[model samples]
Each structure stands twice: as structure tokens, then as C-alpha cells.
Target: MTATVAAPAIRVQGLVKSYGDLRVLRGVDFDVARGSVFALLGSNGAGKTTVVRILSTLLRSDAGTATVDGFDVAARPGEVRESISLTGQFAAVDEILTGRENLVLVARLRHLPDPGVVADDLLERFRLTDAAERRVATYSGGMRRRLDIAMSLIGDPPVIFLDEPTTGLDPQARLDVWAGIRALAERGTTVLLTTQYLDEAEQLADRIAILHGGRIIADGTLAELKRLLPPATVEYVEKQPSLEDVFLAIVGTDPDSEPADVITLEEQR
Candidate 1:
């Protein structure tokens, strides 16, 4: 007997979208495998957000097709919406509500049974339990992003769209969001992450597709993409720390640790 192959969690073929004179997505195509993170790597105005909106049923494509969880985005938008969660560039958390209140509110909105229980579980999962009752106004960027993500997972959607999930965050806060994304993929959820940060893609995506001029310029695993370039040259030069190194050293240096690793700006030069 022939074994059946599981279908991709997300499939987009020849997707086209336009805004009057501006053509955003020109025949875009890609597939996201189950339980994997797919990064739509691109710069601003590369139509990354356009692709996501179409996939989430918030916008329609002029041509081509997209499906989520085996349901056609155009024909069965309701089913597609049910199977996916979308977290846009900015956090959608309520500043007035406590972290726990925000989660419970989403649970109640989804009409889930035992909303409180669901909220508690998610607070624990996202490491927000300790700050559960604290108003979001006092939460840091990382904490707010975590709660936003936790709310998105209330119904346990199989697919998630993270549009520039780490934009505008400090380095440490960005790492926090990356951790949450990894946990999602570990639990068998398909993630479609759109970002301009190449390092973010490198750190989280199972596959990366670079979009430029409204089309995919390159698509592959990091190793595969690297192969497109000439072999890397190995060489050594005088070692010097940059401003980022100086900043990190100043911010994260230990009181009792040796000062050898922490170089002054003068030394960096």
C-alpha cells in the first residue's frame, strides 16, 4: 500500500494583489509544511504584509489561490480564519486590563468552556503567571508581546501569522518573542513569520523565502540559500569590538566578573 503524504499546512500559488497603480504581490507562491516555521523574509514594501492579510482572509487577492489547513482562503474564508491566528506588527493587548484579564477576555470571546482555566494555563505557558494580575500598562515590551501571543493561542489554532513579530523591540525582548515562536512550532503549529530582519529568520525559520520587488527572489533552508553564494573565505584580521559589543558589555556585565571582556569605546577603536 502506498503511504499518503500529509498536505502542507499553508499553500499559496501565483498569488497576486494590487492597490490601484501599485502592484504589491506579483504571482507569489510558497508552501509551509506542517509543524514548521516559514519565514517570509523581505524589506519594507516588499508585500510581506499583503501576503499575510490575504492568507488571514482580511484581504482578497486579485489572482491565484491560498489555502490554510486544507481550506481555500477565498472559497472557505470562515474555515481558513478558524484554523489560523494573526498577530500584526504591533501588540494588540489591552493596556487597562491585567495580563490574566486579557487572556480570559479572549477565551470568553471565543466562547471556550472554562475560560479561567484556559487563561491560567496560557499564563503559565507564556511565563506570564507571575504578572497575571498586573495591568498591561506596567508590562515591558516582551511581556506585552507574550500576552498578545498567548491570547492568539486561545483557540489553539493550527497555523499562526506573525508579521514582523520583533520589530521595534530591544535585543533581549526580541529574544523573548523568538522563544515563544519556537515553542509554538515545537507543539506542531505551523508558523508563517514575516520580517525584514535576516537574523530573525535565521534564528527561527525552518525555511526562508526572500521576497523582493513583489516576488520571491530566493527560497530555501539557510544552508541551501548560503550555497547560492560563492564559498565563504576564511581569513583573520585584528579583533575589535563594535558599539553593540560595548553596549551589551555595559548593560549585562556582572559586578564580580573580570573586566577583560568589557572594553571601553576607546579600546573598541
Candidate 2:
């Protein structure tokens, strides 16, 4: 007997979206494997955010089929919603509530048993125990980002969407967020991330897709994408030979010689 593999955690087939006369997505197709990180890359208004909102069931696609955790996002949105969590570009925690209270509030809203225990555990897990009693407004940017991510785990959904989770964080703080994201995938959670940071995507994504002009212009492992473009060696040597050195190395500025502007990284399969 042949064993059957489960469907991808996220699957979108011929997805098309539009607003009146403007098309935002153009028949896009992609799949994300179970328990892996998938990164979406694009510049401003490239339809990257639209994809996340659609998959998270926050918006409806004008035309196409999308499924999350085996549930149809359009027909069975509730099931899709229940199976996923999203930490958007901005932290959505309540400012009036204490860090602990905010978590407990989320836990309670999820109808979990003994929210206190879950709240306390997440606080410790995210290293927020020391500030548990502090109002969320008082937390620093990085701390709030951590707490935002921790809040998304209240029910431990199998899939999570992190939309530029480390956008404005400093280097060390960004690393902390990356560590937390890694931990989630290690625990068997499927993660879908959207970011402009090549390093972050290189470190976390199992696969990547780059969006441009409201469509996916490139998709593949880093090496594969790099192969699509020509390679160049930029060498440096002592010198007044400055112009001569650069001219010898790069030759001419044929735009095609440059790497694709929108680059996202993914692990090689």
C-alpha cells in the first residue's frame, strides 16, 4: 500500500483578486509544506500583504481557491480561523491591561481552560515574567513584539502568519524574534512570513516566493534564483587604480547583470 502524504498547510490554486477594475493578484499558485516556514517577499503594494490577509481569512479573494490546514478559506472560514494565528506588522495588545492581564484576556477569549496557567506559562516562555504586572504601554518595542507573538500562541494553533514580525526592531531584538519564530516551527507549527529582509528570510524560510506587479515574479531556493541571474565578482585592491579596478571587475552596467531586486530566501529541498 502506498502511504498518502497530507495536503500542504497552505494551498492556493489560481488565485485572482481585484478591486473593481484593478487587479491585485493574477492567478497565483503556491503551496507550503506542513511544519515549514514559507516567506513571501515584495516591495510596497506588491500584493504581499493582500495574500496574507486572504489566507488568514481577513479578506475574501475575488476568484480562486485557498485552503489553510485543509479547510477552505472561503467556504469554511471559521475552521481556517480556528487553525491559525496572526501577528501583524503592528502589535495589537491592549495598552490598558498589564502584560499578564493581556495574555489572560486572550486566553479567556479563546475559551481555554485555566487561562491563568496558560498566561503565566507564555509570560515565562517569552521572558515577560518580570514585567507581568506592568501595563503593556510601558513595555519597550522589542518586549511588545515578543508579547504580541506570545499572545498569538494562546491556543497553539497549528499554523501562524507573521507579517513582518521584526520590521523596526534593532539587530539583537530582531534576533530574539527570530529565535521565537524558530521555536514555533520546531514545535511543528507551520509558519508563513512576509518580509523585506533578505537575511531574515534566508535564516527562517523553507521556501520563498517573490511578488512584483501584483504577481509572483520569482519563486525558488536562493541558489536557484541566483542561477537565473548572472554572477559577478567585485574585487578590491590597493589603489589609485580605483576606476580601473572597478571597470575591470564589473565591466559595463548592463542592468540584467544585477540580481533580482526582490529577493526572498528558502531552504533547498
Candidate 3:
């Protein structure tokens, strides 16, 4: 059998960020193993994006140590930048360029000699081949989002930071992006995703950390976190079963069927 590597893809300790007087991140710490998917969840202003920015070398942390692929984000910023890619909250593709053109531009920026080959490969990988020649301005929201993520892969970085990757996508579009994220993690890319969507965190995260007030309130696997609260007893019914049917099956229903809120094990008193 071949030996497996033990080096972590990302590591951070005492990470802090501030804006004027408000301290955003207060001694944040986390480590992501190579080829794993780690998610950071938080409400707005929880410092999730600030953490990503610092790790990806887009912004400097006020005080901390951050490393990506074993390269220090501050002391070895050039190497750290070369080892990671970041897709911010917004889709950043050039609207005037065609899908193919946008990818080729990224390839060229990476100094790849055969930009056309890289563009063609990414177009097919992202299912954008048919629309490759079409202007990005005419693309749908999902298509633009796909192009944005595809561009991030031009350098094939070992680690990727996706900050609210599905923010504006429709439900179907959101699922498509989720699938793409899963594919990346499966292929040994370490992903640190930040999102407000609980469902997205539940779906793609191998390990999750919840941020509240700029600190990690909870951290664990989904089941571990859910177990922290009461167990959620999920029930299902076929056909036109009323909420009354569900409640009656669990707790005796009132004669009026009162249209009361259903309580799961988590919400039960």
C-alpha cells in the first residue's frame, strides 16, 4: 500500500480581524486536513468572510498565524497564494467576455502557455461548452456562477475558499453549485466554505464550525452538532395526510385540530 500524507491543507491560530473599533474575529482557530471539506457557518457579521479573506491572502489578519498547504499566509504569501483559490460572495466574471474568453483570460493570467486548451477543458468540465462562445452578459444566473467557479480552477490550487458560493443562485442553481463543490472535495481539494445557509452546511460539510459573535460556538460533524440539541425525529407521510394526522400520531390531537405548529424532538418541551 502507498503511504498517505499527514500534512494539513490549512491551519490557523489566534486569528483576529478588526474594523476601526469593532473586533471581528477574536482568536479563531481551526485546521483542515488535506482532501477534506470543512465548513464555517455563521450569521451576518460573524467574521466568516473575514477569516476566508485572511487565509486566502486577500486581506491581512490583525494578529494570527495562517498557513495554506504548509506555507505561511503572511511570511510566505506568494507561495500561499499559489496554493489556494478563492471564490467570493459575488460572481466576478467579466460580463462582456464570452464564457470561453473568461476562462482563457484566467489561464493566461496564470501564465499557462496553452490557454485555449485550459479554456476548452474547463468549459466541458463546467458543462459550459455550448455557451462557451456566447457573451457572458446573456448567460443566466446559474451559468454565470458556474463560469465564476470554473475560472477559480485555472491554476488547480490544492485548497479553495468558497465564501457564500450560492448566495444569489436559485434553488436548482444552488444544487448545481453544491454538486460542483462536492466534486472538488472528492478529488482531494481541501475546501473551506462559509455560508449562512444551514441546509448547505448540512449537505456538504464533512466537519462544521458555527461562528457566533466572532467566535466558534460549536464545532463538530453534523450529527454531533444536531445531537447537541435534542434529536430531531423526522416523520414522513404519504398522500394527503393532514398535520393533524402527524400530530395525532405523535401526540393526541385536539378535536379542533387547532392548526398548531408541529413539534419535533428538538422542539419538544
Candidate 4:
């Protein structure tokens, strides 16, 4: 007997969307396996956000179909919402509230019993336990972003949409967020993120889809995408120091700098 294959966590076919005379997405098609990271890459105005909005039920597609966890996005918005969480371009935590309060608010909104316990658990999981009582206003950008994701997990949704999640983060913060995203996939959550950063896609996606002209122009694993391009002629030249090296030379070593900061700078470059 043939072994069974699990259905995709997300599926879209011929998806189209428009605003008045402006067409945003056209004939897009893709599938995301359960517990895998699927990245949608596009330039600005390439309709990346449009796709995310539609999948999360914030916007309806003008044509075609999309399903999350087997429930039709258009026909079963409630079910779709129940199965997914979304963290948009900006952090969504309340600035006036402490990190713990923000999480507790989400838990209470979710109507989960023992909201305080849930809040504490998420705080600890995200490594925000020490800062849990500090108001978000005093938190760093990375901390705020982490809190946003922790808030999204209050319901333990099976899928997550992170739309340009690290857009404005510093190099260290961006890597920190990337680690959190990987942890999510390892825990069996389907992650669909849209990003303008090509390296981000290359670093995280199990599969990638390039959206252009409001359509999915290419789709595959990173290796498969590379294969579509002509092979480069091999050449060797003297290696030159990168901008990072220049930065390090100028700044020198700071006794106060954390070791992790050095690792983050290297990884980003």
C-alpha cells in the first residue's frame, strides 16, 4: 500500500484581488506543507500584503480559492481565523501595558481559563520573564516584536502569518526574531511569511514563491529556483573585506559588547 501524504496546511489557486481599477494579485498558486515555512517574496507594491490579508480573512479575494487547514478562506472565515494567527508589519503590543499584561489581555480575550498562568507561560517561553512587569514603552524594539509574536500564540493556533515581521529591526533583533520563527516551525506550526528581504526567505523558507506582476512567477525550494537561472562561470579573485569588517575595524572591540552581538553581525552579513 502507498503511504499516505498529509494535505497541505495552506493551499491557494488562481487567487486574484483588486481595488477599483488596480489589480493586486493575479492567478497566484502555492501550497505550504504542514509545519513548514513558506515565504512569499516580492518588491514593494507586489501584492505580498494582499495575499497575506486574504489568507487571514481580513480581505476577500476577488477571484479563486484559498484554504487554511482544509477550511475555505472565503466560505469559512470563522474556522480559518480559529486556526491561524497573524503578526503584521508593525508590533501590536499596547505601549502602556507591561509585557505580561499584554499577553494576559490576549489570553483573556481568547477566554482561556487561567489567563495569568497562560501569560506567565508565554512570558517565560519568549524569554521576557524578567521584563514581564516593565511597561512596553521601556522595551527595546526586539522585545516588543517578541511580545507581539507571544501575543499571537495565546490561542495556540496551528498556522501563523508574519507579514514583513522584521522589516525595521536592527541586525541583532532580526536574527533574534528569526530564531523564534524557526522554533515555531520546529513545534509543528505552519508559518507563511511575506518579506521583501531575499536573504530572509533564503534563510528561513522550506519553499519560496516569487510574486511579480500580481502573479506567482516562480515557486520552488531555493535550490530549484537557482536551477532556473543560467549557471555562472567559475572564477576566483582576491577576497576583499566586507563593510562589516570595516565597521568592526572602526568601532574596535568594546568590553561591554555582548558575544551574541558579534555573532549576529556576522550572520547578517
TM-score, every prediction: 0.91, 0.83, 0.84, 0.90
Off by over 4 Å in 3: 1-5, 232-269
Against the unseen true structure, what C-alpha lDDT does each candidate score? 0.91, 0.87, 0.87, 0.91
Runs of candidate 1 with Cα error greater than 4 angstroms are 238-269
> Model 4, poorest ten-residue lDDT window?
253-262
List the lowest-lDDT window of 10 residues for candidate 3: 251-260
Cand. 1 TM to true fold: 0.91
Model 2 Cα lDDT, one tens digit per residue, 1-269: 99999899999888888988989999888899999999998877778788999999899998889999999999999999999999999999899999999999999999999999999999888878989999999988888999999999999999999999998885556767888899898999999999988888888888888987777788887777778887868899666655535443443332225543443345323
With a 3 Å backbone cut-off (N, CA, C), the pairs that clash in candidate 4 are none
**Model 4 misplacement above 4 A:** 244-269
Off-target runs (Cα >4 Å) in candidate 2 are: 231-269
How does residue 37 of candidate 4 score in lDDT?
A: 96
Give the better candidate number (1 or 3) by TM-score.
1
Preferred candidate (lDDT higher): 2 or 4 = 4
> Model 4 over residues 189-249: C-alpha lDDT tens digits?
9999999999999999999999999999999999999999999889999999887566556
Q: List the residue pairs that clash in candidate 1.
A: none
Per-candidate clashes come to: 0, 0, 0, 0
Error of 2 at 165 (Å): 1.2
Point out the worst 10-residue segment of candidate 2 by lDDT: 247-256
User: Which digits, one per residue and each the tens of the lDDT, describe model 3 over residues 164-190?
Assistant: 999977665776788889889888889
State the lDDT of candidate 1 residue by residue for 1-269, as single tens digits: 99999999999999999999999988998999999999999988999999999999999999999999999999999999899999999999999999999999999999999999999999999888888999999998878888888899999999999999898887767877898999999999999999999889999999999999888989999999999999989999999998757566676633224545555569868
Candidate topping TM-score: 1
